[model samples]
Target: MNTGIINQQGLVFLNATGAPVLSRADSRQMRAHITKSNFAKRRQRISQVETKGGESNKQTTQQALHRRKRSQQKSQRAALDTNPTELPTTESPPCAPSLQLLRNFRYLVFLDIRPTVQDPVEKAWFDLITSEPVVFEASLAGGMRCWGPDKESQQNADLHLSRATNLLVDRISCEQVPSDAMIGAVMTMAFGERLADNDVAWNVHMEGLINMMQQRRHHGVSSLPPVFRSLIALDFMNHLLGFPRFYHLKVVDMLSSHGDQVLSKLAPIPADLSLLKTAVDAPETGHMGQTSHGVEEPLERVRLATRALREFNDPYVKATSRSLEIYLNLLWPLLFTIDLESVGSELKDAMSEFRIKACPYMDLTSPHYILGLLATEKDSEASAWFLDRIQGSVQVMRQRGWSDPLSVMKRGLVHEPHIHHQFTALLDDGINGLM
Candidate 1:
């Protein structure tokens, strides 16, 4: 049996019909070629479809853009229709905002956050940009950050404050019943005076505001908005400082409502003092009677509240708290001054105690220091001390990157006899009725 060798490509197997057949390798090549051709055709079809879809998508995008442009135009037209005097336009390049406007913006932003105006206090505060002279001047007064750094700005602010006071007086006299806006304006003026450390002026304004609210029959704290509650909290603190009780509502009632939470957190006066007193006196009043030990209990609570103030992360808040603490200590030397037998008779003890305990770098030229001296009946000394510290205060504030270095010194300047006539009156009449 002789077997003949055949080339792999040429090798073939005969079918049952005895016909010559393609080798397995040749069959595989044919099938592969067909499959590749089919794939190429399928890919070409897909590419064509994708191209058409892309064109359709481009058209759709163009249509959408056109519609948006039309919608914007319609909005502008509507705005134009609403306001005939002002032309409707898109947001233009912001030119430099006026200083007053900038200040107003900052104030509005501040009002939106905590430790300022919280809750839906009223819609009236948001409507302050009206033509009302009281509102305008009040805004200028409240915008403390804008004008505190310089003498010129300060003078301008004073002018605005004067105008605001005049306007407020007129409004109060004219209106049969006080409006919320008017009330807010008066409160704002009082707050501004407080910030300026014009104790006499602040009390005066605050008294007037209370009178106005009383006239409005807001005897109940619940009748007023949360804004007034915050005001009442301040008044309560003022009461603790020896001012007559301006609020009829108990401190507990005010605290129970939504008010300045920060003040509540750090108040020197506890909310339930009256309740505690009542309970201690009449044990049958409530379950809290057992807890009401004595004045020491309330005093301990006050000390605890003040601890949170010391732990404040904000340096500004801490400094303000320290200043307030020093003021409280300075208020009643007979009651609070330190003695050999007891820790002190006063709220924070004698000025000597603070001198020893206070940080050496503390701003002695601060409003707290000068006012403390004035309250202690050391006017001549306070004036001299304030004058000496004016330069130092300015330098320190500037070093701290404050835009309003002069404001820090000027806060105490209002107490100078040469600077404010009220200071002279304060000296003559004392804290009760200087205004």
Candidate 2:
């Protein structure tokens, strides 16, 4: 109970009272005891002060050292993993990712099941604009869960995309594949590449995809992935968006079927609009190639293809849905903003009208880039609702060790130009609840 290191001998001397004055040796002992007691008291006082000050100093010192060590290790790892002199590439792997390649193979096996969506043939032109952002946002949303880090998920995504591209390219070059296999192959590639932002190689991939679809059109294929309709819709949407013609969805007359001179319609642009639009007449082409009755042939083809992918992966959030709707919602506005002289003014007007109709009706599950579009419009009602929902969802994320979702979106949506202040306010509202 006592903090003082008391001596038994000192207690005995104190108890001696008036009986110890006769002996000189006793007097010396008494004086020595008093001196020792005073020294002990001063030492105790000094130790108490040191204990309080030492603890805070130790904690601060430990934290600083840990931070420095972590920073150094991060720099070292960066130097090791990255090539300072070389540019990073998309298709050519730094080395073959056997595990990722295997994963891609396994994924194809699972995805080839009977179509669930209403079409199959139109899947070649799957939702091109929104796919990339959806993939991107899913990876970010995925960062919240107990799984591999974001970089690993991204690599896994890249692995599937690159592997699919290679497989399809090889399949197209080598020989004829079963119709079902062709649909499955294109679906796999589309699924892999849809969420890849500004991935220009999609045209080459889509070109091959359409070629496969064309070869398989005569024979009816059983079981289409459900997404086939949306894919075809995306192809039309891509053409409408003034992107290059990555697909070959054209209509031929009965005369052409009889081996007569067939009318070949070319898309006015390259499937990837990021590249220069090809020199082609817009008046001669159709965004969705139409048959004699103004029906897109892929309409039925897409309908059959859509039936292929039946079951859906349960999405944890609207942003992670297997369907391309969420990203499409974001893509429409971005597409509307593009002023392409090559595109028919009617197409541009239609897109603008569609964007306006859709813009005010975004649901909570919309991609984060919708915030960028919302910022561009600065719609008071839309902003208030979106900001409220975002605040509620991401507030809980902080407690769960997630980085700010708004900040995440800030980075995700940077490709689109908008009022920086308005966007910043939205981010601050969700992050700091400033709104």
TM-score list, all predictions: 0.35, 0.30
Candidate lDDT values, in order: 0.43, 0.32
Worst 10 residues of 2 by lDDT: 85-94
Deviating ranges (above 4 Å) for candidate 2: 1-198, 218-226, 231-424, 429-435
Summarize candidate 2's per-residue lDDT along 235-327 as a digit string, tens digits: 432333333222234322221243321111112212322221121113444332222232334333323332332122111111122122222
Residue 294 of model 1, lDDT score: 55
lDDT (Cα, 0-100) at 25 in candidate 2? 44
Instruction: Return the top candidate by TM-score.
Output: 1
User: How big is the positional error of residue 381 in model 2, measured in Å on the Cα after superposition?
Assistant: 11
The Cα error of candidate 1 at residue 361, in Å, is 21
